[model samples]
Target: MIALKRLQILLPFVGIAVLLAVWSLTVWARIVDPVLLPSPVSTFRAMWIGMTSGKLGVDFLKTVERTIYSTAIAAIIAIPFGILLGSSEKVYRSVEFVIDFFRSTPASAMFPLFLVLFGVGDRTKISVAAFGAALVILFNVAYGVMNARKTRILAARVMGASRLRILWDVMLLESLPQTFVGLRNGVSLALVIVVVAEMFIGSTDGLGQSVFEAQQLFNMPDMYAAIFAAGALGYGLNLLFLTIERRFVHWSGK
Candidate 1:
């Protein structure tokens, strides 16, 4: 298992290494202009300078903090509503129309309203991220609830379990994996959207702001570095989420 897992992890890195090598060769051959496509060395130098000067490090932390805070807030609010709606047929049916409507709305479209209502600030940025992320969680939680094993539920009822008891002991427990999946998706989306929202809203510092500044100054390498860092964060956090999910859901054991 350990060997297989190690191989699985290494495979992607190997592919990335090959791609980078090709990129380096292509740049060296002048197939891609340095200005159009920066060499890895140049990008790395820019990253190193940004980090050593504390620009990249600071913006990275700020972006991470905002994403974490907003995602957590969204999860806190979404879980309850999901539970309530999921536990009842009537509630689910009634709210499904509204939930579907909001969920279908693009998060970016809501940014203007958020800016007007909250003004350009951390609060508005975080709120937009939280609200956008919450919608995804809400739908997933509802999905988990609606799709829960009906046989298990029927058996519980036949065994004289009360609705509340069935919910706590069966419904919620059974739906945890799906719920976690929702939270994971929400966290990822929150990270992406929050950064975009922060770039224009009122953020003083963040990876998004770094990207914006880089564009304004025509610092392509710096912009690429920040973008690369964002990709790394997303990939890293996704792996972290899988680890946590595996720990909690032992049925998913290797």
Candidate 2:
């Protein structure tokens, strides 16, 4: 049992090791052009240097800043609005189609519209990202609240809890898991939108800009480094949210 548990703990690393091996083999065997796909060492070295002593670090931070700002704005707007809608089925139904429609629209497609509205500034990128994220969060939160266990809500009411109290306690608590799910999804989408916007939105410094510049220059190593940095950021953000959920929403899976 102990051995099985230990194996499970280390299981995720197996994929990493296999991927690295395959990558290294491909590079060594010249299966792909070296100019196109750098060795893992070359890629990591570029990543280390760019992050430590070059402009890549600044660009990475800028992307982080934009993603965080957008996600925060999304959560702030969506959470309360979601609660209101969730608490009233009629209100939720009234605008469900509208919410889903906009949510279905690609954020990239909205860039031109937002650029027209806010111009080619940080405002346009951030606001467009926020708009996309807000719909995802709002949809999840409303469903979470609406799906709160009826038994618990009824029990609260039977115990003489006011509507406000039941909402604050029972419904909100029940909604936390799904809310976190929304947050995670929203942040990911926000990051993607921010990166794409940075690439094309007249930005001077950002991971996306770095990637674009590197690709244009045919600097494959540096481009890979930037790509890995962006991936790391997304993974780190998701892990952070998951950790917070595990701490605060301990009963989430149960």
Highest-scoring model, TM-score: 2
Worst 10 residues of 1 by lDDT: 245-254
Candidate lDDT scores, in order, read 0.86, 0.96
Note the residue pairs that clash in candidate 2: none
- What does candidate 1's lDDT look like per residue over 43-151, in tens digits? 8888888877859989988888888988999999998899888888688998888888987887888999988898878888788889988988988887788777999
Please, what are the lDDT tens digits per residue for candidate 2 over residues 19-135?
Answer: 999999999999999999999999999999999999999999999999999999999999999998998889999999999999999999999999999998899989999999999
Error of 1 at 214 (Å): 1.1
> Number of clashing pairs, model 2?
0
**How does candidate 2 score on lDDT?**
0.96
TM-score of each: 0.91, 0.96
Q: Give the best candidate by lDDT.
A: 2
